[model samples]
Target: MAKLDLRGVRKSYGTVEVIKGIDLTVDHGEFCVFVGPSGCGKSTLLRMIAGLESITGGEVAIGEEVVNAIPAADRGLAMVFQSYALYPHMTVRQNLSFGLENIQTPKPQIREKVEAVAKMLQIDMLLDRRPKDLSGGQRQRVAIGRAVVREPNIFLFDEPLSNLDAELRVDMRGEIAALHKRLGNTMVYVTHDQVEAMTMADKIAVLRLGELEQFGRPLDLFNNPANLFVAGFIGSPKMNFLQGRTDADDRNRLILDTGDTIDLPEGRFTQAPGQTVTLGLRPTELQPDPDGALHAHVGAVEQLGSESYLYGTFQNETPVTVHNPGQTTIRPGDKVALTAKSTAMHLFDTETGLTLRG
Candidate 1:
């Protein structure tokens, strides 16, 4: 196992920079995930760590050794890609042992390693099958097995489960998480899926454009986002935003565009009266109340067995969503009042898109 570190890491295509200065560290045996939207430089950052991309300026170290000049082959890291880059002609066992053979490993050691990895990944029965004959999930396991036999200091995965079906993806996620526990090797994964990052990572690095937005544990980013972008991007179904202004009569009160007023403790906000701000509320935070602060005109309902999600608009036509546990009888065109505790609310500055702590 090894620790991975990046300091002022950067990359650029001529004048257009893709990765601005980024500094992060992945502790030994830690599962670190780089998560962001498409074209957000997550993959580019991963490649730089893998030594597949040249670093424009900065340092990348593995186990206290700076490897900015090291070749990918000599970096002592194995990578599993989204494409399941398996040799079609080789059988599963052969594919797993091919890398060992290239380095002239003893035949007996190669066989032993292949057998162990195959069994560990539960792909022992498919050893004789070719990539063309294996299912997508099976092929992915084989690709991962190929990397495992290498016994590298670090493991890097680039959207390795994106190709699988929804059911298979969930199954593979568990398998991968188990594999991490068993091997206890430092792993760095890059994906656009927030769910994967939230579920698998010991720590998540949220990226946007070319900058690192926030880096912390999943729940930390979820409960207390540093900026508006992190708050909106971290949660599923996303957090809802309402435009409002500080009340002239009371600085601690905010008046929503819909004419609803929310009272806060004295000196809760530093913003003066009439200053525009945004109130962020998660779907789960909003509940149906007879005298709720906000009223919604339901537009759609999504029933998912154990839970239901209501999509609607406020009196000012501002869109909102509410997550209701279990079955919901609420239907389209129904008017409902929603309320949330002030403790569950998040406030942001309208001009800077930054969180307002006080």
Candidate 2:
């Protein structure tokens, strides 16, 4: 396995720059995922690494060598595309053996490699089936198997599970994570889904509009986001941002435009008296309370067996979501007060969206 390094990597379509200078590294055996919303340059960055797209500037290093000039075929990287790009006419076994055959590998060697990869991917029983006859999930396994049979230094997956149904997507996610575990090869995955990145990546690079917003462990980005964009994008149900300003009279209170005042923790937030600040509250951290300090109007309620999610809006009609454990009697149109879990509040500068810490 080889580590991958990207130094000031950039790509542009004529005068339009898509990839801003991005410096990231995926160590040997590390699973790094590029996660962002669509059109955020995640796919463009992946193609740059694969040598499929020319770099506007900067360098790409696989292991110790700069591969900026290397052809994609010689890069020793196996890629699994979102479309499950398999030859429709070829059976599973034939498809798995195609890459090795193109390299003129011995017939016996190709047979052995295909058999091993098929079994590893649990597609051994489906070897005789053509892509036309296989399910979406099965076809995905074959595409992955084709990559595995080649045994490249690194694996690149471009939204490999996007076409699957919800249940199959979850199943395939586990399978891919397990494949990475057993093979221990460096992997770079591109997905717009933050949940997938959180579950599978050793490191995550969060991108926005071609800029690398933040790069770190999944939890690191979740717990202490570098900026408001990362905070809002990394979590499910998403973090709620309420526009407010630090109260000049009460240093520990944040006065919201919605006519609510949220208490700030002592020694944890800076003094930005009277200046507009963004208050971030996680849904999971907000709980219903009778005498809670903040008020919200419930709009909708989602009952997920073990837990409940409530969608609401504050007095100013700013949307907010709250995750409460177990079922709740709270219904739509109900007004509720919420108490934030201790130290769960996030404060950001209103203008810059940068986190405010003591």
Candidate 3:
């Protein structure tokens, strides 16, 4: 396996730039995920690394060698695409061995590789079946097995599990994570689903509108988001935002437009009084309090057997979503009071959307 590096990488077409300067590195044997919303240029950036898309500027290096001009075939990387892209007429075994055959691998070596990959992916029994005869998950495993047979320097997965059903996607997510643990190869995966990125990656690069918003460990991005965009994107239930401004009478407090006050840690917030700041609270961080600062009229309550979530509006306008552990008696149209732990609060500059807490 090798390290993957991107130094000020860029892509453009006719005066329009899709990928703004991106400088990132995926260390050897690490699972790195690129996650963002659609139209975020994540797939475009992955294609550039695969040498399928041209770089408008900067460098792409595999290990120590610059591979900007290297063809995809010579880059020693294996890519499993979103589409199965399997040959309809070929059996699973044939699909698994084709890449090695093209590269003139010995017949015995090819057979060994195909057999091992098939067993490793748990598709050994389906080797004789054609693509049309296999299930979606099986077809995907065949595609992944094809990549595994080659033992490339890096593995690139472009939403490889996107086509599977919800249940199977979860199963395959664990399978791929186990595959990485066993092989220990450098892998770069791209997905629009933050859940997938959080569950499967050792490191995550969150992107937006062709630019990298932040890159770090999953929990780091979750706990210490650099800005509003990231704070809202990385969590499952999504963080809540309350419109507020610095206290005119005191720099260490925020006065929400909802007519509530939040005490801030001294030396943590330096914004001038009256400057607009946003308070972010994750749904999970909220708790029931009889005289809590948050006052909301519950609009909807979802009980999923294990837990419940309350949807409501704070002070008649600002929407709030609260996650509660276990089952709850909270019902729609009921008045509820909530409070947030001091550490749960995330403050951001409303103008620039940058985080205000140091």
Candidate 3, residue 243: Cα displacement in angstroms equals 1.2
Name the candidate, 1 or 2, with the larger TM-score value: 2
The TM-scores, one per candidate, come to 0.97, 0.98, 0.98
Off by over 4 Å in 1: 265-272
Residue-pair clashes per candidate, as listed?
0, 0, 0
- Candidate 3's C-alpha lDDT? 0.93
Poorest lDDT segment (10 consecutive residues) of candidate 2: 266-275
TM-score of 1: 0.97
Poorest 10 consecutive residues by lDDT, candidate 3: 262-271
Estimate, for each residue in 234-285, the C-alpha lDDT of model 3 and write its tens digit: 9989999998888788877788999888787677655778889988999999
Error of 2 at 75 (Å): 0.8
* Model 1 / residue 56 / CA error / Å: 0.4
